[model samples]
Target: MEVNIEIPSHFLCPISLQLMRDPVTISTGITFDRDFIEKWLFSCNKTICPVTKQPLDDDLSFVITPNHTLRRLIQSWCTLHASYGVERIPTPTQPPTITHSNISKLISDASKSPQQLRYTCLQRIRSSIAPATTRYYSSRCKNIIVTCGGIQYVANVLIEKDATRREKEEAVFILAQMDGYDQEFKSVVLRNDDYADLFIDSLVGLLSSESSSNRERENAIKVMKMVYSVADPTRLGSVEHEMFAHIVRVLRDKVSKEATKNALKLVVELNPWGRNRVKAVGSGAVHVLVELLLDERLDRRISELALVVLDQLCGCAEGRADLVGHGAGLAVVSKKILRVSHVASDRAIRILSSISRYVGTAKVVGEMMEVGVVAKLCLVIQVDCSSKTKERAKEMLRLHSRVWKNSPCIPPHLISSYPTN
Candidate 1:
């Protein structure tokens, strides 16, 4: 026969037992609830323990589901419950209907899941909602995170947990993906210029990250370029110099031609020569740039990028001085004037004009001319090079070289008819 207790519904609330409300304990050892204590104390011989007079099992925890006969059996046992762990078999108790606060707390905790799976869930929710709907969610992210702390929880987990190096990199990429379009993203980008430097500094830190794959590093660098595009100097700062050098370093190491192309594009945007500024460290960057000029392994994309950077540097007085001090780059470029195809040769000649005439560079050109770079340049002008190329080369070689002294600054076409080199 089924025996049951008609325990009132209100008595089911563990908090409302006239015992404790909003009960909380950070400690793991806080033992039995008040109900259990009361039950065991009053159970007498009817149950092994007042709180828990049922037969004990080795299971450390229990879960209930509507389909389980055991859950029904446990409910029958609850009517005779005693608080202590050992108990005479007691009738099952009815499970209380869940309440709103409990539901809220459950959701909060679920939302705060620290696993990648949790973010997958959040991303799904975020994508399913309308733009306007997400506006509302935008405000709720903080409190919701606090309750269950999902994104925050994930952030903390990512920051604090021991993940594989590859995992950490994926985590960083995920962070970038998530934060890129946060509706509030522009306020910081637009609201204050000073923060742009901080943002770039942070991105630069990411570029140096070990274990980051080629694709990921390229994306990070692309982000820096894009950020500067919309950024007003008022908001993003005069970071052109720092940005340029870092671009060079990335350009130097980047395996993808596209990365090199993109870097070149950014340098060109800084117009006429972003390279010459002190912060760009004309003194430092020019040497590396020149070395690149000498490296034939560098493609036209890289060479064009270097030229654009040189042009930018020429615009700055300090940059000009820096190149002037590094005469070797121009000397090498001048030497190439003889061997390069028309495209690269003309480009080389133009870059020489771009950075030539600087005081320090003039001396290097002087030494190079003294070493016979001029005759090599003139002989090339005598070859199948374009008229425009020859004209520019003649003008440049004439202006920068001591060897070309008193030599006619004749255009290559005009000189072609009469040259006795």
Candidate 2:
């Protein structure tokens, strides 16, 4: 009885028992001393949430049914949490917000002003956000902001052409930014399949709202450039409209410049199955493109768009050939004697050569060769530097002779007619 036993003063921390209280862990990661822990437990009528009385049926069991002797050891720790807010302490490292207001404002203002003022407005917009704000891909808003930012930047830069050639193209750069943020946008796309369709239609509607100026084509050209830049060609073919006269207007007009070219570029990128819906834009696109090809005054952009649409028409093995084999196909050929200077249309050269390869499309080709497209092909073959253009031109000639064996090759100077019968 003379010998006395003493308990060790050291105890486990209420939060992470790896150490003692000097500090001890409570059920909610709070650290306290035995004294405070015991007091709080007693104050709360033992084994219950102090705040909500929800019952401390949680981890860090020391507080749940803390033995009075040990709980008293943690008593001091209870005051630390009640004084300091724990809910405010969340994991660090969050991302920034996406701000597209400036971009939208500038574009809206530019659309209403004179063309010269519009360029200046774009320059101001580009200078403000071009280099820094857009450098990294944003991970926050499911990439909707990224897509809009890209199309916005493209509106500013595409028309300028060399706008960012030295600094990294806004369009291409935005696309690359999206690549890093794919998971974000992909989720949006999965949730909303019609987003792309809605997006394009909205932009088209916005640009057309400009009533005073004919520069809408220029606006559409730049917008379409960006859209087609990332446009899923296979999915793009499904896009159609009843008011295609607007696009036809863009192609045939001298003011719009590259307007139709943008439209045609999207048309060519599509898979064959997709081409039918795009082709369904009625004969307005075809009629205007053909007529424009013959006019020397017609801008290269229009010619290029027409040629591309025509190429897609003639090159298709499906019902597109049916559209071409009849009067529509002949009408285009009867107009253009030679598309000598209009080389920008990828649709022109690609589809010309492509059309020659399809056996069923020969009726269209027969009309093609007779329309002076073959002689133009021959001229292009002699000197066209691009391996692609040259190769396709060569194929056009071969198909021309094979399909139109009886039709003599017409000299480049004269327009050739399809057999009227």
Candidate 3:
């Protein structure tokens, strides 16, 4: 038979009715677990202690000192009842404080401390920067971190003479984490004309630096992606040529799966701007994307992104020319149309549409016929693709049917099914 032992009511938090972990005293002279009280105070915004009904005040400046005596007594009771599967509570360390004021003070202290103390402070700040860990605790903390100069402090650590590689990586990682959690912070940085370029330039420098680790490079790209996501068209138009080159280089280097995806996204996001598209074409992004498409082991999501980018790039004459110029480009794009997901298929068909409509010289037309693109279009109509996609395919085939149908490059059987515009 299993036996149950009663936990002393004095050892239980009044709010939770569970044995307290890290019990703390409020101004009401009542003790509750630190986690419960904090949530009540900060998240629920309650001014009174749960049991005493005493006012905690709007300012909430009460010190939440640990009740060591109660904690020890709880541990003793657990030991005495060990036969009933009772376990002793481990000693509790300080839980993360969710207040914005505490967060601002933390940032200020880290920024002003001496070298050794500063590093310690940076570590403390780093702990609070985790989105996965701290996001549920407070949104206000994220605001404090950004508005209180925390980001600048972390960046300064990267340039500090005595900082170790690990510390530098931590700083970069913290910035990246902040970007993930805080949308308001992202908007402020991108919209701030004084800081946007300088901030991006620093990330680019870190991405290009020989001494930065692979992880650091990943963090840099992540931060770059977040910044670019919020930047307006006018601001994006202001991006320099060297920045595109670095982005292309990161894609070429294949830093990580995530890094590569973000780099591709950054390129596609910028391609809508004429100047950015020209810069990307100049950086050989077309060739790099085509090469990535040729990889048999590429993840489906990665392939989808690659095709999406290729479709965007093909909007410009230069992008279309690059696609036609590569030896396997037309054939590879045709192969992907029906084989991949609906989005990839749509993007692939659009790329073929661009080539057929805008750049369809006799030779390019002949090549499309020979590469099975015409047959693929016929198959698109027969398949269960989206109506919009089927319409595009039919239009592409009709646009070049005259040149393609009579040519020996097209198969005799498929030619009869070709639709004339």
Candidate 4:
């Protein structure tokens, strides 16, 4: 029979409401479990003490201090109740101290040494350094790691043919986490053309690899987005067609909502560059986006992004043909006109305008009317939307008025608002 012993209320962490293991005292003199407090301050990005609600120091390293007295008390209590199904909490081992010099040397050795040494270094980083240190000193550690050429080292590990699966996953995690620190790290990659190509190629390989996990592919997509954000027009224009194909594949898979959005954003980023729009079209982006839009459960921002990409793709003849060719393309675009946000509505109108202005063959125009697009245009002119959106709608209506003005496809209610000119 297990004896029931109530844990002392005072011995519990204030945040987690459990007996404190590795108890630590904050600057506010409040005791909490180290893991809980670190998660609160670091992972949650909180700056106020949970108990006293006092402001914490900007330098978090000084804000948290280990409470040896409280820890021993809890340990003794656990020992006394060991026979009653309680286990004594062992003293916590100190995390290995990481300094800038330590990181710099580790990166240097990894970069210059043989593959064995490089693997060992990666192990040290993944096990001892990143997880142990990131919990308490994430911001400071990111700066140090980036300054010590950690990005390049990790990228090399990701692309290394002989790297273990675990090591490559760790590298992907590090690269994804290391972004958004500062532009200095990105600028380094951007300035070196050969390194940039290798890095991009590795990421594209991951996206295209069947063996790569969804998490890995998502991280790779994130890193690609960051890289392209800072890439010059020359570099963006020179992106390989295979990369566009893999990106379109990501969209079609709907890997994750965030990954999908990043994929869309990546296409938008590259669309304006030389031949990228054509590349995207050849990769079947238009068909994928139209399919994505047909799903009614999409997020508002996603709808906006899809519309935006479609609009950009339509700038090219190939993109326009793809949209007009899809069975639901015109219908989906017309359906979103007033059903989504103002931005979405505007982009939808722009797509219609593009189709009407360029590809408005008699058969296409007749199909547009049958699909309720001609009616949607009349509604846009009547509704309280942006002036620019209203103008585009009016322009499309006037351009097609000769054919649609007296057409019965438009409802009588919306006919009054149709552009007369």
Sort by TM-score, best first: what order? 4, 3, 1, 2
Candidate number that wins on TM-score, 2 or 4: 4
- lDDT by residue (1-421, candidate 3, tens digit) is 1246777789888889888878888767889988898667644545577897776543333446678998889888888887888888888643465455655665565555534245444555665555545455435555667777777677667556576656667777877777554466465566577677667776886898998777788889888887787788788887788888888888888889998888888877787888888788778888998888888888888889999888988988899999999998998899888787999999999999999889989898888888888888888888899999999988987787667667666667666667766
Candidate 1, run of 10 with poorest lDDT: 56-65
Count: clashes, candidate 1: 41
Please give, for residues 11-38, the per-residue lDDT of candidate 1 as tens digits: 2324234322111211122222333432
Model 1 Cα RMSD, Å? 16.8
lDDT of 3: 0.76
TM-score of each: 0.48, 0.42, 0.72, 0.75
Candidate numbers, best lDDT first, in rank order: 4, 3, 1, 2
Please report, as a residue range, the 10-residue window in candidate 2 with the lowest summed lDDT: 86-95
Per-residue CA lDDT of model 2 for 1-421, tens digit only, reads 1123222334444423322333334556454444455445432225553434454533223322223444443344433343443121222122223246534554554455423233333333333333344444234332444444434443333334333232222233333234344444344332344665554554455344545244444554444445544555454555555324445555556554544556566455542544453553353555555556657676655565566567655544543554354464544543442343445523556654554565536456666765666555655555535777666555555544545534566663422322212
* Number of the predicted model whose TM-score against the real structure is largest: 4
lDDT of 4: 0.82
Model 2, stretches more than 4 Å misplaced? 1-198, 207-212, 231-237, 242-246, 252-255, 269-283, 299-302, 317-421
- Work out how many backbone clashes candidate 2 has: 23
Whole-model Cα lDDT per candidate? 0.48, 0.46, 0.76, 0.82
Worst window of 10 by summed lDDT in candidate 4: 55-64
